[model samples]
Target: MLYNAVSTLGLSKRLQTANTELQLERLRNNDEIASGKHFDVAKALGARTGQAIALRNLYDETDQTLKSTALLQGRLGTMDSALTNILSAGQDVLAAASVGLGQPSPTGSSLQVRARAMLEQVVGMLNASSGNGYLFGGVEVKTAPMRAVQGDESGLPSPIQIVQDAIAAATGGTSSPQTPAETAAAVAALDDLFATPSASPLGFEGGFYQGAPSTAPRLSARLDRTTEIPYGIQGNDPAMRDLLQGLYMLASVDTSQLPLDAYKPYMEAAVAKVSGGIEGVRDATAQLGIHRAQLDDIAAMNTTQLRILNDQLDAMESVDPAEASLRMNQLEVQIEATAAATARIARMSLTNYL
Candidate 1:
């Protein structure tokens, strides 16, 4: 059958489409060279799209968790320093109290001064903020967990007085006793407060802690695909509270008013509490160390996983540089041939056709 005259519209459209395809190929090559990956993430992976997507999502989540872990690490680092200082202060108080038992006026004044300084330090730590939130406030991240000054129904008296009264109440009543019995009572009171703060008059509600629910959701960070870590040591923690209580008691003592015998008992009680505080802080630091180790392991796993995922993705979509260059060169030659053919075809006359 005789063919109709070549349609000019179709020829022009075909030429335009060929030129567009060439441009798109060049653009895709450039993109591959620049990105070192497939031009289209999903299309390149084809049957492997599900796994590629899942791996990408997993990496993204792991990356986000690592970021969060970094931030939490900073906060925990601050806590570590604060707790160390507090532990040291407790040791110092014990030493000073020991010395105070020997010399009445001067040594006692020194202990009191040191205790006051430590009180400031401890309170500063308790109310410390990292980034946008308080360190010791647990879930109540924005609020200060400890107050240096005294308060009314909303809060208790100065840290020392509240501790003293709590101790007194634990023994029997809040009546003043100029004896060793009072010191023992104060120790019992501290135990009572930590044990059942809400039940006791000088509970966490009335005294020191000002944070989220009593059992706040722990601050957490991602460890891996199937693991997470929870943390956020609060001010009301027995170890921290005991440390503060020791500092308060040391600051409250008056060497002149009480005889060395009475003073000795007070210091003894304070020393025991302070020692407990030191142990508590040490334990917290140790636990933080464990978390840091875990993060390191998780980070390593994340890096390895990401590398493997990237390799798989590259395999799916990456154009070999040498092959891409050869293909590009081939396309360039084809275009040149097409241009020549079109030029020759355009010049064909009706006379030549007849």
Candidate 2:
């Protein structure tokens, strides 16, 4: 066959183009081997690139949501622990009060002291917090949910003083109730003071609560696009109010100063109030347990969804290292062969053949 200049030039150009193409293929395959992922995901996936992007975005969002859920779970757990501690403290006071009623102590001195210490302990627990914020603050998480028992220079009456004033008002400035009628009136006044919109100027809400009010929205967390859980418990809750009221009633007066007429009726009322508070706290704790279970379920479902999403993403975007390496080796050999052929064609001449 005759090898004309035009045909030789055409052949040489084609070989050069083939060599360059093989070189590019080798480079792409090498990259795939190193990275374990498609070098150009959009190019490899074509029209389906959007699906891959959406899937990856969804995976990222779910991961973020799972992290948030974990934090919420931690907060809920912290609140539950604090509330359990409060229950324990309440029970201790109940036991002390029951013992006082069962046996005679000089003016119930031991019971009074126990109630005061436990009252402080319970208030401290109600003010518990974590990295996120205060556990019992409701929607207000930055500050302590319960005020210190001692009022500040701001002139607010201390919690103990509030209880004392309520008693004085009910008993007509007497140290203890004068009769059964006075004892009943004292209990009613104490209840009113600790009620939602307290009757006294320095009642529970006015003097003790430092967090969100009852009318404000409760704290909550979102598990997903559609699921939200409200798990906040405030210090001013009715159960907490009753428990504190019972403790304060015992702690505020010296039982030694009281006549039997006042002391017997008073101790019985406190015991009953504390008992009711214990039951209410247990119910609240049970409700928190239910919420925790719900969070566990949501977390498990999120884990499963993440796993499936990861698998799908891997199938779409990952490459096998062994296969990529093998292809790269083949491309290298083809590129070398094409380069050798192009060089041979460049060296060819009519004079050499002659």
Model 1, 153-220: lDDT tens per residue?
55447555676676556546643335666656666666566553456765655466667545667666
Q: In candidate 2, which residue pairs get closer than 3 Å at backbone N, Cα or C atoms, i.e. clash? A: none
Residues 177-222, candidate 2: write the lDDT tens digits.
7677888899999988888887677767768887888999988888
lDDT of each: 0.70, 0.85
Stretches of candidate 1 exceeding 4 Å from the true structure: 1-4, 41-45, 102-105, 149-195, 198-202, 217-222, 340-354
TM-score for candidate 2, please give it: 0.85
